[model samples]
Target: MFISFEGIDGSGKSTQLSLLRDVLEAKGHSVITIREPGATLLSESIREILLSNKQTITSTAELLLFSSARTQLVEMIIEPALRDGKYILCDRYVDSTTAYQGYGRQLNMEHVELCNKIATRGVMPHVTFFIDVAYEQAQQRMQFTPGSAEPDRMERSGREFFERVREGYLAIAKSDPQRFVVIDGHRNREEIHADIVAYL
Candidate 1:
């Protein structure tokens, strides 16, 4: 089984994914967890460049970079693991590109969808859980203290951008109800985990 978790940064998708992984493992299932633009050498390098606050990358460039990293990850790790009958739990996936680049950045949907198709080579997740959180709540969660690590380039895209991204996720979920599960992120962690586990 292939499962993907999607949400804006600080929406708790990662925590839920970790929790689900633990539960699945305890049940004797082989599972592998990975994050987008990461989990592989090439992808990790791209992740650094993509997230660097100092770098000034255009929206188009960002989309291609993310796609490139995804291609490498899918080819190197995800595909093989799934073939070995392991459950793949991904922190983020193609939907992120659609939300961030397609909606947040206002890129052409056609181009974004084409890039997504090429990147994954049609390998989509069996299920995608979108943890929905309000923009204000997400911002509050993302706030950093003095001397702490600063927000990444993407994280600093401001309110309007993330609002559009959130809308994009909701739209995507609406379009694919069978594969996409929208989970309210305002609830307690245990409640959210219960819903996810119950779905599985």
Candidate 2:
């Protein structure tokens, strides 16, 4: 089974993903975790470029860069793992492009979807979990404390952009009830984890 997790910048996706991986591994399932634009060496380089603010990128160009990363990840990691009957847990997949590019950047969603199909070669997740949180709440959680990592381009997109991102995720969740399960991110940590477990 392939499981994908999606959320805003500070929606506890990393934490929840960590817990989910541990739980699944404890159950003795063969599992591997892959974050898009990462997991592979070349893709990690691509990730740095994608997350930076070094250039003013067009929507089409942004979509293509992300798709290129997905293409590399799918070919080098995802396909091989799944072929060996390994359960793959991915953080941030093509839905991210749909939200960030398609809605937030006002790009053409159908074209983005087409690009994604080529990226993944038509491998869809068995289940996808979208952590639902308010844009304001996410911003508060994203505060850069002392010793904290610097904000990426997506993180610095401002509240209005995040609002559009929230809407994009909800729209995706609403469009596909069977594939996407949205969990309110305002809940306690344990509560959120439990909800994900229930959904799984």
Candidate 3:
């Protein structure tokens, strides 16, 4: 089974993803956890460019660079791993592009969808968990976290942009309810993990 986790930054999705991976591995499943924009050498380079605060990248350029990184990840890592019948647990996937570029950046949604198709080449998760966290809480987590000494460019997108991205995530989930399992992000880690495992 292929699964993907989606949420805005500091939504606790990564924590949940890690917990899930551990649980699945304990159950004798071959869980392959991967983060987008960093699975391949080229993708990791693109990730640095995307997150760096030094250079000012245009909105269109940002979208294309992300697409390029995703394309490389899908072709080079994701597809082959799935062919080997491993359970892939991805930190983020196509929905992120839609939420960030399309909604947060106010880009064209239709164009964003098209770009995602080209980038992913039709590969999608069997199930996607959209961890629903309030924008205010997510922002607070980002700000107060110890390792977050310097906020990345995307993290500095501010409250309004993140609110829009949150809404975008909900809309995407609403449109594909079957493929998406929306979980409350406010709950305790163990509780949240229990809910997610129940779904599986």
Candidate 4:
């Protein structure tokens, strides 16, 4: 089974993903966990470029860069793992492109969808768990104290951008109810994990 988790920066999707992976592994399943824009040399380089706050990248360029990274990841890692009968848990996937670029950046949806299709080569997760957290709450979680690590480029896209991205996620979930599972992210970690496991 291939599963992908989606959410804003501080929505706890990563934590939930780790928890789920642990449970699946304990049950003797062969599982592989990976994060998008990473997991391969080429993709890792692209990830650095994409996330660097110092680098000024255009919206179109950002979209293609993300697609480039995703293409490399899908061809080199995801496809092979699925063929090997392993459960793949991905931190983020193509839906992120749709939300971040198409909605957050206010890019053309048609182009964004086309890019996503090309990047993934039509491969999609069996199920996608979207941890839905309110934009305000998510921002609060992303807040950093003095001397702490600063936010990444994407995280600094501002309130309006993230709000649009959140709306985009909701729209995607509404359009694809069969594969998208929207979960409330305000609850405790254990409760969220139980809900995810039950869905699986």
Question: How big is the positional error of residue 194 in model 4, measured in Å on the Cα after superposition?
Answer: 0.7
Worst 10 residues of 1 by lDDT: 139-148
Q: List the residue pairs that clash in candidate 3.
A: none
The CA-based lDDT of model 1 is what? 0.94
**If scored against the real structure, what TM-score would every candidate get?**
0.97, 0.94, 0.97, 0.97
Off by over 4 Å in 4: 144-148
Per-model lDDT = 0.94, 0.85, 0.91, 0.93
Could you tell me the C-alpha RMSD of candidate 1 in Å?
1.5
By TM-score, how accurate is candidate 1? 0.97
Model 4 lDDT per residue over 166-185, tens place: 99999999999999999999
Q: Between the candidate structures 1 and 2, which one is better when assessed by lDDT? A: 1
Give the alpha carbon lDDT tens digit for every residue of 2-119 in model 1. 9999999888888899999999999999999999989999999999999998879999999999999999999999999989999999999999999999999999999999999999
The predictions' CA RMSDs to the true structure, in order, are 1.5, 1.4, 1.0, 1.5
